[model samples]
Target: MAKIKTIIDGIEVEVERDSWAIDVARELGIDIPTLCYHPALGPYGACRLCVVEVTKSKWTWLATACDLPIREELSIKTNTPEVIRSRKMAMELIMARAPRAESLFPLAEKLGVTKPRFKCRDDIGNCILCGLCVRMCDQIIGVSAINFANRGHKRIVTTPLHKKADKCIGCNVCVEVCPTGHVKTLDDGSFRHMQTWDADLEMLHCLICDKPYIPAKQFKVISDKLEGIELKRICPVCRRKETVDNLRYAVVEKVS
Candidate 1:
């Protein structure tokens, strides 16, 4: 095992190499709050909540601890006044953008950020787009149906071609990973829609089953493909079972 040394909150601590900065900080009784940084999912560093000041030689820069790997002779400052200010600013910005959001409000309050300094934009009402939803879809579920479209301030997540996304696998990983409940699937196996006051839609399909279950709008597309197929009326699994049973009966009649 490689030995690593890092300074956190002005105190030096020795840790194992390949360890994440957040895990090392916790061992030293330092708390770095985070969302979208689940242990199981690893770190996407999208929330920007786990930012830390890292000093190496003459360079001092802000880095996300959740994404940083431990290295020898590294200096990390988790709770410096500057770091606290930056964290508060990030919280304020996220809060202003998603005021009524469930997860972020509690974290903002905990960080002692009560109000935003700048005037809140009317469009900043939902989904800060930290990339948690997109990452979960691409990384965990292996479905790239949802993605960040546009660029910079105008960047927003959407399906392919801004049309109903036929590539989605109907998995709810995006919904589960979304910090705000903006991405959600309905009861039917149709498409997932972003809950906005305006009408913006996204869609997905099942990879294995090939059933048009999710995304109601895309149902027509899938239905058209199944129009001539004998198994069109039922779902994929039921269709396969029916075919197997029919083949068995045909074989038995031939034997008789």
Candidate 2:
């Protein structure tokens, strides 16, 4: 490991090169607040909450600690007046767009931000579009079911072609990874559906038989009776033959 020297809160600290500034700070017992920085996923630096002033040789600028790599002879200032102001502003902006939950209130108080300064959007509640959920689903889980669509203020997360997503495995990994409870999973009698800021699942019907095969998760409660049954896009006649054949083969193997 290469030696990395950096200044945090005017104190010199040495770290391993290629380590993130956030990890370095944590080692030094300095807390840098962040929202989208997950250890399991790549840092997008979208939240802008962990910005810190860094001076490396001649170049000096604000960089995100979550994304910045420590180098030799790097100086980092994490708790200056300017840094505190910027952090407070970022927290206020995020709070304005987030739900008024009890968890956020104490954090706001700790950051010295009493109230939000900007106008709150009507659609703003839980999600800040930090891309943590999307990155985890795409990079970690290898399921590209959800992504950002549109642009700027009109931007929203959606499935491909803005159509009902057929690739979602109902794994609920997205929900578990989200920092805010923006994505919710509800169980209907036929299947489990997820609700997020941008989209909802549509009721599914069998194309060949025109039977109501799946209801929206928010509409009905799933019962334990239908737990192991797989709901595929097939009619009862096709499913009966497949199930019977599998059972027959299992019985023959047991006897043999």
Candidate 3:
């Protein structure tokens, strides 16, 4: 990879070309806040919280640092008044949309937004419409179970027809990736329920402990991917115990 020299907050630093501006800034100890940015997901820039002022010759403008690729002679100002104002505005709007989101409060305070000037209905849940959940299911998990529905004010993440998602494997990737506490899943021994997507999948019991470990559909996905490798239907704890027991037996035999 080629190296490029970029100026961040007036400090010149050499970084790998094609690296994101936000990543480089973070590595340089420059605090750039973000919500819709994740190392795994690779920068969707939906939140607009990581905005930074970019200067190139006479042209100067603000851009989201999450997806801004590092280029030659790129100049970035992370904590300028313009950048701070932009982030605060984005945070304020996000707070209004997700008023009940406990996670946003800390970030909100950090950005100096005590309260949002805009007000939304109380029914607006913690979903910030970041698309992390939708992207995780479709891109990484290879299951297009849930997606954005409707437009503008009526926009929401939901399964098709607001019914049970047939393609969902109950993997809980959506739940894990959700920044807000919007996506939820519940396990009641026999079944794993993805409440957000309206999916209920049968749980696969551990062969050794007889405890429900993983969802059957999720196990099938893993099984299919591994091909000929024989997989035991045991939980992680039992698998570790079995490995230890096998090693102990081998040691005893050798000793005898």
Q: Judged by lDDT, which candidate is best?
A: 3
Among all windows of ten consecutive residues in candidate 2, which has the lowest summed lDDT? 216-225
Q: How does each model score on TM-score? A: 0.67, 0.71, 0.92
**How far out, in Å, is residue 49 in model 3?**
0.7
Question: How well does candidate 1 score on lDDT at residue 20?
Answer: 94
Residue-level lDDT of model 3, residues 72-164, one tens digit each, is: 788899888998899999999999899888878898999998879997647757999999999988888888898999999889998999888
RMSD of 2: 9.6
Report the lDDT tens digits of candidate 2 across residue range 30-144: 8888878888876678777788988878998888899988766778888777788888888888777774644567767888988788876658557777888788778876667
Query: Quick one: ranking by TM-score, best first?
Result: 3, 2, 1
Look at candidate 3 and tell me the lDDT of residue 131. Answer: 94
Clash list (residue pairs), candidate 1: 168-205, 189-213, 189-214, 190-213, 190-214, 190-215, 191-214, 191-215
Off by over 4 Å in 3: 244-256
Angstrom error of the Cα, residue 122, model 1: value is: 3.7
Clashes of each: 8, 0, 0
The TM-score that candidate 1 achieves is 0.67
Compose the digit string of candidate 1's lDDT tens values, residues 77-107.
Answer: 8887778878888888777777778766777
